[model samples]
Structure formats: structure tokens, C-alpha cells
Target: TMTIANSIPSEENNEYCNQFHSKYEPKEILGRGLSSVVRRCVEKSSKTEFAVKVIDLNNLDTNSEDARQDALKELRILRLVQGHANIILLHDHFETEAYIFFVFEICPHGELFEHLNKVVRMSEKRTRGVMRQLLDALEFLHSRQIVHRDIKAENILLDAEMSVKLTDFGFATEVETDDCLTDLCGTPSYLSPEILVVNMYESRSIRVYGRPVDMWASGVLMYTLLVGSPPFWHRRQMTMLRMIMEGRFSLDTPEWEEVSEAAKSLIASLLRVDPGQRLTSVQALAHPFFAKQELPCVTFDRRTRFRSAILAVRCLCRLHRAYAMPARLELRRLRADPYTIRNMRRLIDNTAFLVYSHWVKKAEDQNRAALFENSPKMDLAAQDSG
Candidate 1:
């Protein structure tokens, strides 16, 4: 493979001739895909950790001209989208005798799909935080005329802060004016109606699809995050595809009860059968679903309030029982002194305030804790109002 590396006629391959092992020390394998293996690597000088994808070019299947083109395309897309905050950052690339090494910022928290599986579902606030970042990333890509054909939970990475880092450019492509992407690609669960239409009737269907397909997939991701499953999942693949093509999915199920109407409305717009009618990334970000609502001035819960009131009453009752007899004799004498009665009233008010304040503080703490439970550090209060 090394001797034949120069035989590849691509100019892009010539740009990267550094030995992969000379600069970075490769560590344990992080993951493996169809044609590549991702391993953790650290730069010798900077000692900065990164994820390196090593693609072997020795195998006959991976050494073809088409394979080389695909690799170059991915590298181009990564370089184009690198600086965006939400998109994965590509540091550098290297080419050796038998492998191509692409170094990217390491995301230690793993895939969002794995996180969703562990939590089952996410709170609306957390879901909003994730969606906002995802949308912003898409907006950047679309603005540049690049479409990420595959947008699924598995392709999204989570960092230590739980922020989104969209990855996987294996199917991404730049769209030119008047370009019609008819290739049947992407995971089945996230396929847009237009894409499926093309697949169902390959030659018969002449419909064009591009960026809106990504919006549709984002809608699927939002639904999955909020409801714990894809909107159009089914036992039969054909049935699921039909449902997707028809835009058939219900948000009226019990799982959706807790989700806000604004969120449901946004999802509806994204899932529109007609690509032109679907909400673009900019429109989706401007939707009311992501608008920041003010948290209440006071975190009040009925049970907490009631418990405080009950306890205050119980204390009063116990005090009365212990002081009733003494109070009768003392009242006659004390009633003559207006100052004593005023002092007693002030004491009672102070006691009540303390009891109420204690419960309210406890409830507020509990709310904060629940908002962050098993989640990343994010400003959820701005996104979620409990």
C-alpha cells in the first residue's frame, strides 16, 4: 500500500504525507465503523488528546477510486465546517503507507444516542438546549450550501459539558445552485419523505431534495429525544417507510402530554411532506419553541405550601395546648398592656415566616437538582420553566 500510495492520482492525497505515528501517540480504540477505526491519540508536543480516525486503504474494497473520492469528499466537508462551534472540529490529517489519519477534537461523553438510551427520554428544557445547538449547526451548514445527508442521534456527539458536536460526514455533500440530490442514502429511520419517494420509485420519481431533508431528520431527532422513540418506527420496514412518506405520526400519545404545544408545532412544521413547506433552520431557531420564557419569581408547589401551612398549624395547636391554662390567667393581666400583645403578635409572624421560607428554599433546591439530574451542565433554567 505504501509503494502504491503515490499511484493514486488525487492531488489531495499529496497534501498529507506526514507519518501518522511520528507526531501523535495512539491509544486505546475508541470506536469502529465500516471502513475505519477511531482511536484516541495525544500530540507529543502539546500533549493534547484527540480522536483519530484511521482508514485503511489496503483492502481492495477500500482502495478503489470511488473509495478515495469519498474519503476526499469527507475531508473537504470536515474542513469546510470545522470552525463552527456546534460542528465537530477537525484539527489535521495525515497519510501513510496504508492508512489515512484524520484527527478531531475528542468528545469524551460519547454519542447522544447512548445518552438518550440511558435516560430513556429528556426533559423539555434539556431537549431544547440540544435542539438549539443542533439547529444552529445546521443553519451554518445550509448557509454554506452544504447538506449533511445523515442527521441522527448516533452521529451527534456530546462533550463533557453535554453540548452537541455534530459529526459523521460520510454522507455529506456540497449543494450547488440547481443541484438535485437524488441519491438514496441516510439511516432508514431518518429518511425524508422525498428521499423515500425517490427510493420507492427510483426512475419514476423525479422529485428533487436537498437541505430540507436535514430539517426533517432534525424533527425526527427532536421527537425521539422527547418521546424516547422515533415518530415513525414500526415492526415492518415497509410500513415505517409508508408512514414516513405519508407524514403519519401522532403527538397525541401519553408520552407527548408533557411536551409543550410550541414544541409540537415546531415538529409539525419540520415534518411537512412538502420540502418547501418545512421550516428552515433559521425559521426553526426563531420558533417560539426555543424562545426564553421567564422562570417564576417564586418556585411554588402546592404540596410544599400545604405542608408548611399544616406544620405551622400543628405547632400552633401544640403551643395552645401547653399554654391554654396559663394564657387564661395571664391574658387578663396582659390584655391591659397593649405593648405585650403587639410583641406576641410579632413573634408569631416571625415564626410563620421562618417556616414558610424553609419549605420554599427546600423546594427551590429540589427543582434545581431535578433539572440537572443525570445531565450536563447547561443553563436549563433559561430553556425550561418548571
Candidate 2:
């Protein structure tokens, strides 16, 4: 590795790059995705580590504007919602004519999906605890008029302490609470029924979709966590859409046998087909599902060879949904990114590290104070109390 420069003296560094090379040296790559890659980097001055999300604008899938906008949207959204504990911090942003760089806090534990792969099933206590943090972050985003169109296990990052930090706001958008957005965004399986055109098969009309989409995805994530698979997973897009529009997911899986009724109820309300009927972030927090639960460890009753085989297959199918959207099409009204053989290998091989540290009891006082120090806690607290 080249030595960290004493100073990066260049015209663009003076304008776009934020003393980048002079202060930090790029290290090993941490993760990869469709159009971007994250690298582990360290600050020479402080020896502090961070993840630099690098996007090469030229290679950023030119077929559609959504691919490029996802990058810009992430930057804008990060600027808007940076202080929440459960949201990843964007320490700095740098740009050149051909590239955009986002300096984020190092999430050594990669993603929640990787963690689940190892632990198999999470106990209700752990799942509820995570839901609290996830909802806390979601509540803040919704209050700021921002909707994180993408909410999945891979997009969520984990710090060393196991604190859930929602990441990847590339598809996020800000809109008025009462208005509707007409974009078909987010991963296929995690998408809410309200946004799909086919959902209005009987009475076709453009509908304004909004925050409830994230709530629906949260339901998918919650169900995936408890049962080891997504509520919506199928081979083809139309097949998946049909199941999603019909709300064909159920809590009848064998793994859900030991799961609680209250948890199932929350998932039902979140995965509602009608946006008007879905739970808001605040309402989800107050639901009985997030209430304190006893017996802190999760138990997966089936470890038989057959069950393992089924889980492995389901896991691959779940991963496919992330990259299943086709790349380009001349659909009458809508445009989509071309889907060649782009993410075929990722499904069979990709496993993000989802490890996180349980909040240390020794620093309980400090951690608790820091949790809401600069966050939008009062709004939710007041609403819950009322």
C-alpha cells in the first residue's frame, strides 16, 4: 500500500475531494454490490477506520436513471438523517468528475443476512430488541418526510456492538406525508403490493404510494428472521407479484410453530395489501410484538438433514429476489434497469456478515444516554405515552 500522503495537493481535491488521500489510506475491500463497492479505509491521523463506498459514475448502469439516482439519493438522504444511532453515519462525502465517494462508519459485522446464516434463528428477545432499533430508525426517516424505499437484510449494516444501522438509502425519496409516489423501486420480494401496477388489475389507476412500503418490508424482514425465509419468494417475477398482490404469505411454516401469536399479528398488519390498513413506524413500535418478551434465546426445532436442505434452497431463492429485476425494457410508461446475468452468482455465493455486539452492560448508562442523545426520540416517546 502506498504511504498515506502528507497532503493531497490537487485542483479537484481542493474542490471535491475532502483532503482524502492526505488524511486516509484505502485498505482491503469490505463488500461488493450491483454498481458500487465498499472498501475498508483508515485515517492516518487518528488510526480510525471507516468504510468508503465508492461509485464509479461511468460504469453505474447507464441503461436507467434509477441506478444513478440511487447513488445521489443516498448522499442526500444521509445528509438529511445522519445523527440517529440506528442509521449509519456518513462521516464525509467526496466527489470527482467520474466518481463519488461516501465515507461511512465501519460496520465490521457486514450485514444482518450473514449473521442469520450463522445463527439460523434468532430468539424472540433478540428479534424484538432489533425491531425496536429498526423501528426507531424508520420513525425518524418518516418524520423527516423521507421514505427508505429499500429495506432488506443486506441493506442493514451492523457495528461491532450489534447495534442495527440502517444503510443503503439509494432508493430513498422525500415526499409530503399525504401525497403518493409512483415509482416501482426496492427489491422484488420486499416490495409492498401498493406500488406494483398489477395490483390494480381490476381498476387500473395511478396510486400515490408512501411510507407504508417500509413498514411492509419490515414485516418481511421480521418474518424472515423468525422463520428463516422471506414471506414472498418465487422463481419468476410475475409469480412473485401475484403472491405479493394476493398477500399469499403465511405464518404456517414449520419454523413458526414455536413463534408467538403477537409476533404473527404484527407481521399481518405490516404486510397488509392496502397501504391505508398498514401500520406506521410509530404504531409498530407500540404494538404488542415489540413488547418485552421472556426467554431470551431462539430455538429452531428442526435441524434434520431434510430441513437443512430446504433452508439452504430457500436461502438461495431469497437472495435471487434482490437482483431479479430486469435491467431494461420499453414498457409503455415505466423504465427499468436492464437485468442481464448481473447478479446470478451473488445468490449462490453472497453471504454478508451480520455479526453485532450486544450492548455491553458495563457502559449501560452511557449507551442508554447516547442512544437518544441526538436522535428524534422525543416525538416517538410522546406519541407512545399518549
> How do all models score by TM-score?
0.72, 0.70
lDDT (0 to 1) per candidate: 0.78, 0.73
Tell me how far the alpha carbon of residue 33 in candidate 2 is from the true structure, in angstroms, after superposition: 2.1
- Candidate RMSDs in order: 17.4, 19.4
Spell out the clash pairs found in candidate 1: none
In terms of TM-score, how similar is model 2 to the real structure?
0.70
Tens digit per residue, CA lDDT, model 2, 102-217: 99999888888778666645788889988889999999999999999899887888899998999988788888873468767777778888788534555755367888889999
Model 1 stretches astray by more than 4 angstroms: 1-18, 60-63, 202-206, 294-386
**In candidate 2, how many Å is residue 242 off?**
0.4
Worst 10 residues of 2 by lDDT: 364-373
